[model samples]
Target: MIRHLVLFKLNDGVVRDDPRVVEGARIFASLGEKIPELRFWECGWNVSDRPIAYDFAINSAVEDAEALRAYVEHPEHQAGVALWREFATWVIADYEF
Candidate 1:
């Protein structure tokens, strides 16, 4: 299996309560149900206020690299990404287990 993790930092002046950000989070929150390749999914806003902490995070898993690719290319996933691009920047890591 492969674990896909992502951390997102909101852009300056962007808050989680903003309509676009809320919609973006909603889109992502639903991707696990919409994408067949997603074997596991957990995502949420951070609870901490640490200076180095990212504002949001996603923890997901797939069967393999191919499944991961399919998840990345899925239309619903792409739509969420497009919306996030306007308000945040993110970093990701994928690893096999």
Candidate 2:
């Protein structure tokens, strides 16, 4: 099995109240369930004082590395990026056994 996790920090001035931001999150959360490779997915807001709080994050588990790769190339995920492009300024990550 493989785990795929991604975290994002939204661009300055972007807020949860914005319809675009809301839709982006919803679309990604749903995409996790729609893809065959995505076994688990969770997303959230950062209430902590961490510097990364400005970004939206996605943590997902996949069947394996191949599936993880496929997940990224998948059409739905590609389409999803369109929404992410609107507000993300930076990202963080961790991938391991």
RMSD of each: 0.4, 1.8
Error of 2 at 39 (Å): 1.4
lDDT tens readout by residue for model 1, 1-97:
9999999999999988999999999999999899999999999999998999999999999999999999999999999999999999999999999
Number of clashing pairs per prediction, in order: 0, 3
Local accuracy of candidate 2 as per-residue lDDT tens digits, 14-91: 777789888877888788678988888888776777763556667788777688889989999988787788778545
lDDT of each: 0.96, 0.76
lDDT value for model 2? 0.76
Point out where model 2 deviates above 4 Å: 52-54, 92-94
Worst 10 residues of 1 by lDDT: 24-33
Badly placed stretches (over 4 Å) of model 1 are none
Question: Which TM-score value belongs to model 1?
Answer: 0.99
